[model samples]
Target: MTQSKSIAILIADDDAEDRMLLREAMEENHLPNELFFVENGEELMDFLCHRGNYADKEGYPLPGLILLDLNMPKKDGREALKEIKEDVNLKHIPVVVLTTSKAEEDILKTYDLGVSSFITKPVTFASLVEMIKTLADYWFDLVELPKNPKL
Candidate 1:
């Protein structure tokens, strides 16, 4: 297994406000990690595959973790998660489903599709900040993540 010392997170979401809010949450909590954003699954795929507009390393380094939203244009998280988990080169990257949906079927399906965790997006900014902080504390500060093995 191999990996980078600097932790990186890729957030795939279509909502502009939500993206800004998430960034603010991390900033408020004093969380220091590289953050990448994609508005849709197609953009995310380009970023991950180093294709088209995302070919540069600064624009598209493989992320350590992915925070995915369920619904969006071009492609959705469910579709993206399935493709990612199926890809031999990309399957090892831990993905956490962060969405507004609390539907039981969505929850079960995401987990079954190999999402590492599933979290419902909270309404308030304060709650969301807490969520991100807790996630950072656990995933980055506490839990020992598997070293990304390059195939």
Candidate 2:
């Protein structure tokens, strides 16, 4: 269950501006991968679970990496992380916490919940782009992610 190759990166953030910025950064960095977006944790879970509209597997492929934002409406990232880590099939996917909060408690909590990494959202667009490059380099280049079992 060895998605070593560059696979789709799913982002679950409530902020439209943040999502747009992330997309722009990925594009600016020329990351050759698909980018999927979910507005909140509920939507994120729905996407991952392939429920309802996401029932079509081909249309919504399993993500190799998940960039999860900590705070969101309707089932926050913490809850989503708990569910994902508890599930046998979904636990394999790498979940990186990318959020604006730099609280130690949040960090500790997410790490304890089994998040692969926790990244503080950069304020500036340039800084964000740099972060995205580094993230792409690490996850897509250096690290070998767990293979997508659903694939």
Candidate 3:
């Protein structure tokens, strides 16, 4: 199924270079969905809960998908994933863990915390673009995501 163009994607990552690469990869894939970024998990929660700088709900619509990094400062992805799964309003959003770590513990932990999918960051830019394309195809064209109610 083709997803709505307005369905935003929220990405939580601390490394600026990684975020830039991800953005470039997404651009290479020519994804139609809107993309938003947060420096850390704190900002991610703020965006999701409409707190602090994210108070304007219209300006920051709830995302249909979230790409989270595991080892961010000031509340990591694991904590954020737990909170997202626990919250009734946010639990429906599909969260995919995209990080550099390949530790089995992190993988198992994130899965236990209710992450939809976990992908290790690819080493090459070309690979990243391919990964992004596959991800977009699966999430935006294949899967049926729940419609989020306007806040």
Best by TM-score: 3
lDDT string, candidate 1, 51-110, tens digits = 898888665778888999999899999999999999887898889999999999999999
Q: Stretches of candidate 3 above 4 Å error? A: none
Enumerate clash totals for all models, in the order shown.
0, 2, 0
Q: How high is each candidate's TM-score?
A: 0.92, 0.95, 0.97
Give the worst 10-residue stretch by lDDT in candidate 1.
1-10
Q: Summarize candidate 3's per-residue lDDT along 2-115 as a digit string, tens digits.
A: 784867999999999999999999888778878899988899999999999999998999999999999999999999999999999999999999999999999999999899
- State the local distance difference test value for candidate 1: 0.87
Query: Cα miss at 79, model 1 (Å)?
Result: 0.4
lDDT of 3: 0.93
Model 3 vs. true fold: TM:
0.97
Cα lDDT computed for each candidate against the true fold = 0.87, 0.90, 0.93
Candidate 2 shows a clash count of 2
Candidate 2 C-alpha lDDT tens digits along 15-121: 99999999999989878788899998899889999998788888898899999999999999999999999989899999999999999999999999999999999
Worst 10 contiguous positions by lDDT, candidate 2: 1-10
Which rank order by lDDT, best down to worst?
A: 3, 2, 1
Poorest stretch of ten by lDDT in candidate 3: 1-10
